[model samples]
Target: MVQPLDSRQRNRYSRQLMIDSIADSDQRSLLSSRVLVAGAGGLGSSVIQYLAAAGVGTVGIVDDGRVKRSNLQRQVVHTVDDIGEPKVESAARFIDALNPDVTVETHATRITPDTVASLLRRYDVVVDGLDNFATRFLVNDAARLAAVPFVHGAVYELEGQLTVFRPGGPCYRCLLPAAPDEETVPSDEPMGIFPSVPGTIGTLQATEVLKCLLDLGEPLDDELLRYDAADATVVRTPLEPNPDCPLCGSDEIDDMDDIDYDDRYRIED
Candidate 1:
């Protein structure tokens, strides 16, 4: 059932309502959507804020980490007061204050193999803001199995990338069959990302999430977009499911059971 926007809602969302593509109905659709954000770090900061600002009805935040003083640099949702608090809690507080009408579900737990399936099944879509390749790959498989569309964003130093994976499209595995060796990939190269890198990429991820929810605009499905902060350039790459892809290929493996997420492989974002 579509809930009509009240006068206060209309006034509060005037700017967004003015957009040609976003009608009151689209706002209502956004209000009814369920989106799960997989992390509460740099990328997650912008994603969570924008989604709440847009009135996504239910936003599930999954993260086990606590806010640290260092996190304040990019994790904008948290503050000095939030340090030592669970990231999920701090994020929930941020959402509640930003949009009280929006319900926030806080899962202060890590996304592990045992928890991934159950966690993902609860939301219509997911936004990836994970730091490690291990958890990122895990979410990809779970999303593929659940048939839910997920927006993936990653930042490295001054660059970032964004993509979307759904049931019928090429998955992350199709883009990279295996994680790169940690030694060759260098785990610490992008030690501390430029704050704006994740911020920009996360904002784009939120845009894609809105597109997926509203069925408006072209989504990043089947394509990879890399954003270079140095020159402010975006490179788009077409993607296709490899026949030998482990997840969504014709001869795909049974499941993600045999895979080792800790086998660090880093793909340049």
Candidate 2:
């Protein structure tokens, strides 16, 4: 049964309550949802901020790294005071400060195959703020097999992309079937961030998550939303599930066991 919202919630979410689609009942649903953000860097920073602000009942943050002075450029959730703290801990603190009604579970560990599915098992939605394609594929496979929704976002110099993947919808694998060589894939951390790149992508990702929770707007499940920060243009392209996709079709991957995401990071054939 959904819990009734108290006066405090009403006051906290007053502005959002004004939206016709997110009136009393929808606010209650948002208050009862659980979301998992897989990284605590640039993308994770903004994703965590908006989800907590929107009053998600439970927010799980998973990151194995500590904050550094350099991370402040785009990691909006962490401040200079938290420079040496672990990202999950810092993000938790930020959420607590913004909305005490939110319950944050901090996992100061990496997203390895052994822990991915188990960690993701309880959340209603998994937001992929991860930097590498290797781990993103692992998350995509786990969410697909578990029949959970995965919202994916990534930012390069001045470009980024966002998409949603669920049971019947196209997945990351449907878009990029095989992991590229380490040398060929771009690194998650850039020499210098444009600042707004992550900010833009993360906010759009949060919007998608909220839409999924409330079932209000159309999701980007069968399309890729790409942003070009320099020119401020967004292009939406249609996508379809690949019948031969190794992770979601005839040759579907059902679990993380058969894949090796370690140094080589390849799907086992």
Candidate 3:
């Protein structure tokens, strides 16, 4: 039930439509696609920008936080005037201004095990832009249970990582297996992040989303793409689904109740 591109769409996506892999049909797929962005911070900002500009028909933004004066350094979608506004609302405005064709659904709320599954079912793909490991693991587990694709991205200082997990593929749990010891996890100190790090990873996450929707290029299926911004080097490492992975392995997860994420991550004040 794909719609034909109108005059406005043709003009708006002229450059993209010219790509041999992304013609009218692919563009139509993008128009029919629905993507959920997990956060509205640095990575979410970039993911939303490109996804909207590329004419994604529906985008759902989920974040319970509000903008702060400190977030302006890397969260590109929010402005100084939006510092006091909700991140979801600020991000929605940015998307609307970027492309009116895009429909943005904002969930100005926190993501939890109970709500994560419901949130993910509403979208075709999930973009991981969350800053914390707790929410990230929640998303990872939820997407796997829903049998949906999750584009994973993370940034720490000058380093970033990108990966994709879909049904029957290696998942986030396969990589981490278990959360780091809460006691040993570093507190959110003033660890300087090169602004471009998240930008780089977020853009790659967007690229993965587009490719997933269009089925064009090879996805990072079982491989993690790591980027070191300081050295300007990219490395690809192959990953295999852990046979013992409780989430996506021989001991497949049946529901969210059995898992305990409470002690896994501690929120810093």
Candidate 4:
């Protein structure tokens, strides 16, 4: 069982609790929540930091990439000295220093079909910070298998998108029936993400995660929040579950053997 925050923690979280929408009970729920954040890159940086600072009980970061000097532009969690270090390790170190109350777990490897279900089973919520559609699809399927709510976010150039996938809401597969071909997508290194693109989307993702954990306010499930940072406008679109989606439709996934990640977009897949 999770322990209640002491006076210091309570005081520290008072501002958040004071919000009419989030009271003491909500704060307590956040204090006991466990969230799994996939990818520690641009979006992951903001998501992990915000969730940790908000006093989430446990935050698991899964990423196998190393911090590069170029990542410093938007991957705020790592510093120049952190370059060459594994992203999950570097992110865990930062979260530890930021809030000792939040337990940080590191999975220093890419999330794959074989490993996703087991990794997700231990957490109450999953944050999708990945940049590719294939992994996004896998994440949606894995979360369905684990039966956990997931917050999803993505950024490209000046545009960003956010949504929540609750048990009955539209899944990622419903958003895109099939994964985009690898040759059609470009990596962040070549595509060039505006520093604020992921920041905006990731912060929104963190907000949804907190709302879901606290059961406060309406979560973003079934709603697509799109931000055109370049134009400074935010738009909302309602998403409905695709009855024909093979992964999370009316037909349930029967066996783990049905999972595969070979079609996932990657720099060198």
Candidate 5:
């Protein structure tokens, strides 16, 4: 049962509460939902910030790295004081400072195949802030199999893209069936980052998550949103599922158990 909002909640969320679309009941739902952000880097900085500010009741953050002086350029959630601290721990501190009502579960570990599904299953929505292609595919495939909603966002310098993959809908695989050959894929870290790019994409990702939680609008399940920061232009293109998509195609990939994501995946013939 949904609980009544206390006076403190009313005061804390006064502005959003006044929003006709997100009134009292919606605020209560936000305070009761759970979201999992898969990385704690540039994109995560913004995703985590907005989710906490909006009062998501439980948030699980997973990152196996530590903060470094080099990361401050775009990782706004960490400070120089947290340089050596684990990313998840620093993210938890940031969330706690912004909203004590939030419960943070920190996993200072990588997202390997063995643990990805179990981690993602714990939340209502999964926000993709990962930096590499392999892990992104791992998440897409896993979320599709688990029937969970995955909000994907990626920023490379001044360009980025955003899309949503909900249960029974087209997934990331439907857009890109296979990772480029090892030698052709981009490096783990982009050549350069126009800091604001991540903030833009990540904020949009948070918006999609909220929409999914509230069921307030149409999802981007069949479309892809792309952004170009240099000229500040955005293009929303229609995305059609590939009839031969490896994950949800004529030849479906229902199990991810033996898929070697590190080697960029393969569907045995």
Candidate 6:
């Protein structure tokens, strides 16, 4: 646990604290809050950088990928010289250089069902910067089990979607009852997303995480915000809690270990 910073630290964040919605205590909450960001790629890059700059106390980054030349296009934290370096390591270095006040933990491994629960239990909030449906579902279910809130974002082509999953609000499974067919869901390699797509979505994820931590404004709780960068239009839609939602529904979930992804998502051969 991190103790609150002294007057010097508080002075540094004074401008932000001035916002009526976020006072000194809220700033302290941000400083003491811990966030776990999955995937240190495009989206994670922005999420991690912004949160660290905002003085988030502890940030945990999980990524098995290496910084590639291709990633430099969107992953602002990594430069051409960083190519071939482990993403989590690279991200941690960037955060440290940006703000010594933030303590960063790097997990240079892929997130799997066996590891998700334990990883989620360590953080106050989780940011879904993952690119695949499989991992997204894993994070969502794990966060629900840990009873922690998560902000999710997805980017494909020029479009992006973002939402917040509060304990009582609708979980991601409610909106995406089933993962898209593997054959239909394009991989980041082939899909070739625009750099700005995840940049925008990831920033929104960071914003929501800060708001949630500080108990600030109206969170997306039961709503999804979609952005069309080409048209510069954002559309908001309400998400209703599914009575049958296996993860956060009315039905009792006997055990976290018992929840199966295959039953929830229709994966095609």
Top-lDDT candidate index: 3
Instruction: Summarize candidate 6's per-residue lDDT along 89-199 as a digit string, tens digits.
Output: 899989988998899988888788778887887799999999888788888888887889989998878999999997878898898877876567654444668888888
Best of the two (3, 5) by lDDT = 3
Give a tens-digit lDDT track for model 2, residues 1-269.
77788999999999999888788999888888999999999999999999999998899999999999988989999999999999999999999889998999998887877888898988999999888888888788889888899999988888999988877989898998887876776655455568889988999999999999999789888999999988999999998999887777765455677555555455666
Error of 1 at 63 (Å): 0.6
Which 10 residues in a row give candidate 5 its minimum summed lDDT?
Answer: 260-269
The CA lDDT of each predicted structure is: 0.86, 0.87, 0.88, 0.84, 0.86, 0.85
What CA RMSD would you report for each candidate? 3.2, 1.7, 2.9, 2.9, 1.7, 2.5
- Can you write out model 4's per-residue Cα lDDT over 1-269, one digit (the tens) per residue? 64666799888888887788876667778877899999999999999999999999899999989999999999999999999999999999999999888999899977777777788877999999997777777777888867899899998889999999998778887888776665675433356699988988999999999888888789998889999988899999999989887767755565446644454522121
lDDT of 5 by residue, 1-269 (tens): 77899999999999988878887889889989999999999999999999999999999998999999988999999999999999999999999999998999998988877788888876888999898877888888788787789999998889999999887668887877767776686556346888789999999999999899888778777789999988989999888777777677655455677454545544444
What TM-score would every model get versus the actual structure? 0.91, 0.95, 0.94, 0.93, 0.94, 0.92
After superposition, which runs of candidate 6 have C-alpha atoms over 4 Å from their true positions? 1-7, 186-189, 250-252, 263-269
Q: What is the lDDT of residue 116 in candidate 3?
A: 85
Cα lDDT tens digits, model 1, 1-269, are 66799998898788999999889998888888899999999999999999999889999999999999988888899999999999999999999899986999988998887788888876889999898776888888888878899899988889999999988889887887776667866655547688778889999999999889989888998899999999999999999888877568754345545444443422222
Error of 3 at 64 (Å): 0.7
Candidate 2 global TM-score: 0.95
User: In candidate 1, which residue pairs clash?
Assistant: 180-265
Q: Per-residue lDDT for 260 in model 2? A: 54
Measured by TM-score, how close is model 5 to the native structure? 0.94
Lowest summed lDDT across 10 adjacent residues in model 1 is found at 260-269
Q: Could you give me the TM-score of model 4 versus the true structure?
A: 0.93
Candidate 4 has an lDDT of 0.84
Model 5 clashing-pair count: 0
**Worst 10-residue lDDT window, candidate 6:** 260-269
Query: How would you encode candidate 3's per-residue C-alpha lDDT over 109-179 as one tens digit per residue?
Result: 88987788888886899999998777888899888877889999999899999999999989887888666
